[model samples]
Target: MTTPTAQTASSLRAAGREPPLPFAVTLDDGRELVMLRVLRILPSKRIVGEAETAGSRMLAKLFIAPGSTRHWQRERQGIEALAAAGIPTPALRHAGELHGGGHVLLTDFLADAASLSDHWQAVAGLPASHADALAVLAPAFAMLGRMHAHGLVQDDLHLGNFLVSGGELMVIDGDAVRSLSPGQALQADQAAANFAILAAQLPAGWDEHIAPLIDAWRQDGEGLPTLDTAALRERITHTRDARLKDFLAKTLRDCTLFKAEKTFDRLTIAVRAEADELAEVLADPDAAIAHGSLLKDGGTCTVAKLEHGNRPLVIKRYNLKNTRHALSRAWRPSRAAHSWVEGHRLAFLGIATPAPLAMIEERAGPLRRRAWIINAWCPGEDLATHLAPYVDSGPPPAEAEALRTLFATLYRERISHGDMKATNLLWHDGHVVLIDLDAMQQHRSASSHARAWRRDRARLLRNWPTDSALWRWLDANLPPA
Candidate 1:
């Protein structure tokens, strides 16, 4: 039986979040660092955690990949460079080799600091033009401006890299931070390319509204233009498209975000941090389905809600009726695999969907058979039932706005939900979450998308009587195909 290993960083990362912590590691100088909680892991390669040294708390990075000298040196140099350039970064406290192999680095832990990523998430669901959205984003761009003025560039410029402490923004992730030219403002093109990296991380429709905040990216002494230029926006679009391509690829592999195992006979993958909790379900999904509370038992698929620890999860099984049905689906990717990939795609686009946790497929050499996909359960009521009372009248304010935003985003991204019944849309946490995404697609060609979206739009309208006030309002409000 092939099972997850215990000691290697790879298996430890695949272990569920809250893996046996307070792990001790001896430094080259004979001092020991006891890690109590992990903050992040680059599976099989590195780990960042909160640790103790002689009774004092600090942050530590363990570069566990064998002979990981190149990354270690770059990290050391990057932090040192940020300090030299007068950027506010976590102060480096220690750097040395681990007792046997790999390397370790330590830095001061800011107990009160919060990542900009968390702050952004609080306002991300708001309309793109809302003041709160701009408020959370301005400081990040202003901080990036300061880095540019110092000729510093962070390749992965996202909210998580900036921390809020004592009413100030502090930069981290030194490994991705480097210099174009020290103590000199970046040239026009160089600054655009760097800024685009950050902009690409923002939600869709934000690129059009960032013009007002362009001033924030120009520090008092940067000697840069105040206006948002056309070239910069175009660069942001290009980068964003390329990033989406890269992210979808990560969904199927054993990366930091996922733990995957693939073979011609079988394929399985799960959220890296939750793999351990989901092992029993993965080891024998049929047995799990037999014991679970079945939600559906159809000819094509079956669904059941189950729990691991305190977290509720939904598992879906794609069934084959008989030999003919099995042979037909054998040559194609299972619907379960398709939903897994599409779920990740929706998340990357900032669209709402049940968080995909795992995917499994049974195969005969190159041929596929029964398969399953698991998702974090969404407990919200379906849109059809939620709106039953509002059929004669329009939806409430929150529902109205959320519906607009969801469709507008879909139109902007050229996405079409193949089955547009209201039952597949769930009213969740102040937004409408998309479900049953095996047939969903984001079209590349504008003309082709229009044709498909017409079908989707008309299908949704057919859900209600033509004369219902809700139906009329949606027809007028929704974006044209």
Candidate 2:
């Protein structure tokens, strides 16, 4: 393909701008292809672009990294092999090294196709019935089973690598495809492993549908193994948990870190906020706290309402009561950190909570003086206040259902709000939003979870007092451990 000259490269890099579209690349056979849009940019100086030659649309992948020709060749071999085996994949048009030190591969572009990942997101957003969701996903399971029956294994098998077009599931990115024997079916163990890879990508809270999906897969192939649903569920859960932990670690590490120039104090903002404005607040937190509208002023902590960029927020300041308390909290993580992490954990688990904005901690040498956490202010009455009128008669059906959903989510995730008093829950948008995440935690041991669960229920019942109608209703309707 045509090499980018120094002048062209300079113009592309002007003002740190990306290369403009509708660029042209000439193949070794003197055919000129014009790229219309960039698809993806990979590490190692590789780019995939949507290109056109004559009147046909094509996908062109260019690799500029040294020794990329071998990789390109391997991908070509995979595509050819799968295509020869009657597997659906893009048709390869050309593969060759460019005049410069790079390589390029061209393939026919599948128009009107969406990646399985994108399709899943769209379907999940729709107000579709459970049957509709199953119909959409069942075909993907069948296709996966068929591939394993044919002894084809995709090393990087994820929803993103498959495409949905014209009511058919098509596999792409053939570079990772492997075959056991020329035509022999995969072994039972290999099939199970491949199935686990696909299962790990299913959306959370869909564990109930695993058996049905497995049945659908088995209907498509005769030689498939009889997968143990429980065993497979464990494997999928383990993989999903590991991936979530890694994602959370990376998110926290890469979040914006703000340092107060004058106080040498530090703050970390989880969500995007104006650095200068936030820094001003962190530099003199006491003054800001004093000026803001106070919500609570207790011996151990204080809460206030403040605004940034015309957006209201609630800031909770955890105070060190005495010299002993200050010394104890000096070299350890502040309560603000715990709240920040628990808030994110709840969000990740799909539980409703006020959005956490930022966390600030002040220290004197090795002694931490105080810490603060800021969250988006949500307008709603606390659950106890909201349910006061219904305590004697029990909540309305809709409200009762909402409460049951809240507890069900917590139970399914093995999470317990350490202080589950009704005041810590809010009635908003027809759902219960959890607050005061400083003590929220997920338990790994069933016994520990049961103990915390009992405590949570007891605290919740205290709001209703005695064996009131509301208490009786909750006792009947709340999910069991």
Candidate 3:
């Protein structure tokens, strides 16, 4: 059987012929269930649907692939075991093979529960206070501890596998759940590893809640091994960092959230939208750059403003500075790629930056030439411009606080802006936004990072002449050595 493409499924739905339901199946105990609405399409061509019987409403997972009955059996066993262990799980209704070439498992439908992933997304979008966020996530941490105390391991640790409703936490999709020996519980190391996997999927600022979350979990985790909170925090950070790197690499290569097309040999364009309009610009990037309103023009690079989809955008072209520079960059990745990746990295770290729309590069056989990175126009002045009038006096408390938060984030993340000039930092929407990210990178060694931080501080101080009040204020407020 051919798997259905999203487009085909959409077309079928438009014609009111998709989600074929109202199908009947007989349970192992001879009860009949009528599947009413398709809930979702699972991997391996299986279908999850809402079903009804004479007595109740249910959820039915129909496995259509050949030789999939064994999976249904495993899921049934896992759910039963988990429920027997006093864990919250969906009540299993029936499990059996369909007459024609499939297997079916039925369970009670969760009426008002939402997946943990969805809940997290919703809560993360709100302008909630730190205390509120901690309050929301404390229960989830406690639930994981309960599972570990009972020797239960959810191999598929995705947030979507857990559900929340009426102040209760429950686990779903039990196919990958595992158990230790009858009398055993999760060791400290195993429990920490499990928490790390789950925490890695939380929002970017989850690190702030780690201590409180662990404390809450420990309170409820009776009989569980004692956890080393520091070790668990380190493990969570390490795991999250690795995942971010992999995610950035994949996004750049595949333009996962953007549209990408190779318009010409050795010339590829990636954009957030309006591919046709962007294609015209990429056709001859130099001509487009020349015609756009110039923001900066230097021997090595050019920045310009252009309009796309009725919104202003800024494009920065990275040109060869000189013969030596051209030779050095010939076979290396374009600076455009660097900025694109760094832009995404900052966003993932919950730092503010201009939204990168697209990047275009011209390449020869093993040689990269001119490149351009386009960003949505940010509507605020640079820090230098914003603070020019304050040179004779100190910056206001709010501005000082913003600067402190920005530098503290940089210090904590080990990110160093090679050239930390005030002009490269924008004051936008009550926060600071870093731009020109080609020189931004996270260093590995403490010594190297410190060296970069010293340089950044020196550059920032030099923004004002000697004996300036702003400079003195900044020096006084600089992040501690």
List candidate 2 segments past 4 Å from native. Answer: 1-113, 122-129, 155-158, 165-168, 173-176, 180-182, 203-205, 255-327, 334-336, 354-381, 427-431, 479-481
TM-score of each: 0.89, 0.72, 0.73
Q: Please, what are the lDDT tens digits per residue for candidate 1 over residues 1-481?
A: 2321233343444554444565777777888778777888765578898888887888999888766888988888889988998889999999988876778889998999999999999998777758998889888888888888888889988899999988888999999988888878888788888889998998778877877557778744366534447888889889998999998898888877888988887899999888999999999888878877899999999999887677888999999999999999999989998999999988988999999999999988889999999999999999899999999998999999999999999998999999999999999999999999989988999998999999999999988889999999889989885
The digit string of per-residue lDDT tens for model 3 on 248-293 reads 8754653425555543446564654545667766667677777789
lDDT of 3: 0.75
**Least accurate 10 contiguous residues by lDDT in model 3:** 1-10
True-vs-predicted CA distance for residue 407, candidate 3, Å: 1.5
lDDT of each: 0.86, 0.73, 0.75
Top candidate (lDDT)? 1
- Residue pair clashes in candidate 3: none
- The residue-by-residue lDDT of candidate 2 on 1-481, one tens digit each, is 4543331222322412245566665666767667777776553456677988777889987765666776787778778877877777778998976543566789878888888878676555222236767777777788777777777887777778888777667888777888865576777777777777777666456665687788777777757767877777777788768766864564345332322222455545445444555666655667778879999998778999887667887889998888888888888878887888788777666567898766777756544568888788888789889999998999988788778877987987788999988889998877789998888888998889998998888888878867689988888877663
